[model samples]
Target: MATLLLIEDDLMVRATLRQILERAGHVVIEADHGGEGLSKLEQQHIDLMITDIIMPEKEGIETIIEARRRHPQLPIMAISGGGRTRNMDFLEVARQAGADSTMAKPLRAQQLVDEIDQLLRA
Candidate 1:
């Protein structure tokens, strides 16, 4: 099983994702926001990262960029439910930044597992 990093600001979302990933047999490390996520990344050996965009402290796109610099081969999956204004497509921006994949929220747990499996295999 891969050690996956999950960075999301919403408590419910984070909990739900953790459950799903755990059920799929992944060892998930949680972070409430991008800054904390970055700290976790520095402290451990992460095989993959699943992050939400529009988060507090340090947005996901910025996290992806910085994490890429630190671990260039680390696979990242950027997820977003849009922003407050509903005008920003942050997922696209995340791709431009360095995310290996992007998914919209409310994520389908099976698809999420499949994607993670694919990333880990790659």
Candidate 2:
């Protein structure tokens, strides 16, 4: 099983994602914001990262960029429910920032698991 870092500000959403990932056999490390997520990434061995786009302390796009710079080979999956801005999609921005994959919320558990599995394989 792979160790995953899950960065989400919403407590309920974080709990739900943790449950889903754990059930899928991944060891999940939870962080309420991107800064904490990056701290965890430095402290532990993380195979993949799943981060929400909007967060306090640090947003996902900036986090993705920094994380990518620090760990270029780390797989990142960004999730967002913020929808579109005047011109750009949050998920698309995430990809541009350095996320390996992106998903919109509310996320489907099986699909999430499948995507993580595929990322781990890659």
Candidate 3:
């Protein structure tokens, strides 16, 4: 199982996602904001990252960019609950910044797992 970092500013989302990942056998480190996420990266052995695009302290794009600088080979999956429209814009920004993949908000746990696996293999 991959050591994953889940970065989301929403309390509910963070809790739910943490539960899902832990249940799936992933070693997960949870962070409620980008700043905390960055700190965790500096302190953990992360294999992949799943981050919410919109966040406090630092946005997902900024986080991804910084992460790329620190660990360019790290795979990142950026997600956002931007309704529908313009959501792609956020995803695109994350991709350009550093994320290897992106997913829409309300992420299906199965899909998240699939993407994480795919990124790890890639």
The lDDT values for all models are 0.93, 0.93, 0.87
Clashes of 3: 0
TM-score (C-alpha) between model 1 and the true structure: 0.96
The digit string of per-residue lDDT tens for model 2 on 1-122 reads: 99999999999999999999999998999999999999999999999999999888899999999999999999999999884453338889899999999988889999999999999999
**Where is model 3 poorest over a 10-residue stretch in terms of lDDT?**
82-91
Candidate 2, after superposition: displacement of residue 48 in Å?
0.1
Question: Model 2: clashing residue pairs?
Answer: none
Better of 2 and 3 by TM-score: 2
Residue lDDT tens for model 3, 14-118: 888888888888898999888899999999799998899988788899999998899988888899887336456888888888888888878898987777878
lDDT of 1 by residue, 93-116 (tens): 999999999998878989999999
Off by over 4 Å in 1: none
Clashing pairs in 3: none
lDDT of 3 at 65: 90
Give all TM-scores, in the order shown.
0.96, 0.95, 0.92
Please say which candidate is ahead in TM-score: 1 or 3.
1
